[model samples]
Target: MTATTIPTKTIYAGTGRRKASIARVRLIPGSGKLTINGLPGESYLQYSPNYIRITYGPLHTLGLDKEYDILVNAQGGGLTGQADAIRLGVARALCNVNPEHRGALKAEGHLTRDSRVKERRKYGLRKARKAPQFSKR
Candidate 1:
């Protein structure tokens, strides 16, 4: 009788938020590839180089850009917010893979969550801060 065993790859998870967007990211061992909400990352991001670069910033900073496949579930907000969220998520996931990477990621600002969001409109204002035109009679 012969016995065989299968190798299993570990999956690392992290969550990130920016503005109103939230992203859940997973890191799996493989050639570099990114998928968001079941769609190819490039197509989902509208093929924008800036967005692509933003999402991969952490990996590049650590020189691990081609070490893993990234799967993300992102929702809410615009593309920019989602991209930032993904960047943070990836950085956090890398930290899980190896905590030593934290300092590098933090230094690169990839671990910071942007706190800016839309301001609420005041009851007497036309917009968030716009006031009615002055009437000099």
Candidate 2:
């Protein structure tokens, strides 16, 4: 008996992060290449390993068999934060692909947003939490 296979619905999503000033981005399967917000001559190869690892999470964990075009737009973060944020976004997109994976992705904490960010400084302080030097003798 010949068995028939069912087709899975493809889902498209976007993610972004801010680190210092640079933004990180990630997109789903595309035409054998990655695109980033229309910045010509830009390649995914230029990004760090973390960015690569997270952006390609669905490919590695869920398998790269998928073939779809994803566009990413990110800004206002350093490469590290951007990379992490991108991972968060991709993980989210994957969940969209198949809601069943939510448990696994959530267990891994990939779906959670990073709350750490730069804190604004207050008056009479050198930094956000730091205060002026005080000496009493």
Candidate 3:
């Protein structure tokens, strides 16, 4: 008896961060579909067109929107931060699939991680840098 071996699909992975959010993304060769935290991206993103568009920026830039499937696990931060993190993760995974894509992705600014986070509150201050109001007696 002869045994047949099945081929396994290869997956490319990337990690991205924005503010306090982090996203781990995987790319597999398949029909265009995006899932986040085990839910369809559109549903997970609450059908927000803006978010959907932002999340697909890298794919759209490379004209490969319908060529791959994306899976993402994102945590921390707010909705906007998560969306941006996913975008960066997708762009990185695309680059991993093809290093040549780096130039394009870089030019599109998807490779840059936004580092702006909430400022930490300082001691004896109302806010990060604001001070309590004072009046001379």
Candidate number with greatest lDDT: 1
Model 1: runs farther than 4 Å from truth? 1-7
lDDT per model vs. reference: 0.92, 0.57, 0.91
What would the per-residue lDDT of candidate 3 be over residues 32-62, giving only the tens digit for each residue?
A: 8999999999999999999999999999999
Instruction: Write model 2 residue lDDT over 57-124, tens digit each, in one string.
Output: 65466554356444556665555665666667666666666688778777777777777678999989
**Could you say which candidate leads in TM-score?**
1
**lDDT against true structure, model 2:** 0.57
Query: How does model 2 score by TM-score?
Result: 0.67
Which pairs of residues clash in candidate 1, taking residues 3 or more apart in a chain or in different chains? none
58-124 per-residue lDDT for model 1 (tens digits):
9999999899999999999999999999999999899988989999999989999899998999998
User: Which regions in candidate 2 have their CA more than 4 angstroms from the true location?
Assistant: 1-11, 16-32, 39-47, 65-69
Model 1 is weakest, by summed lDDT over 10 consecutive residues, at: 1-10
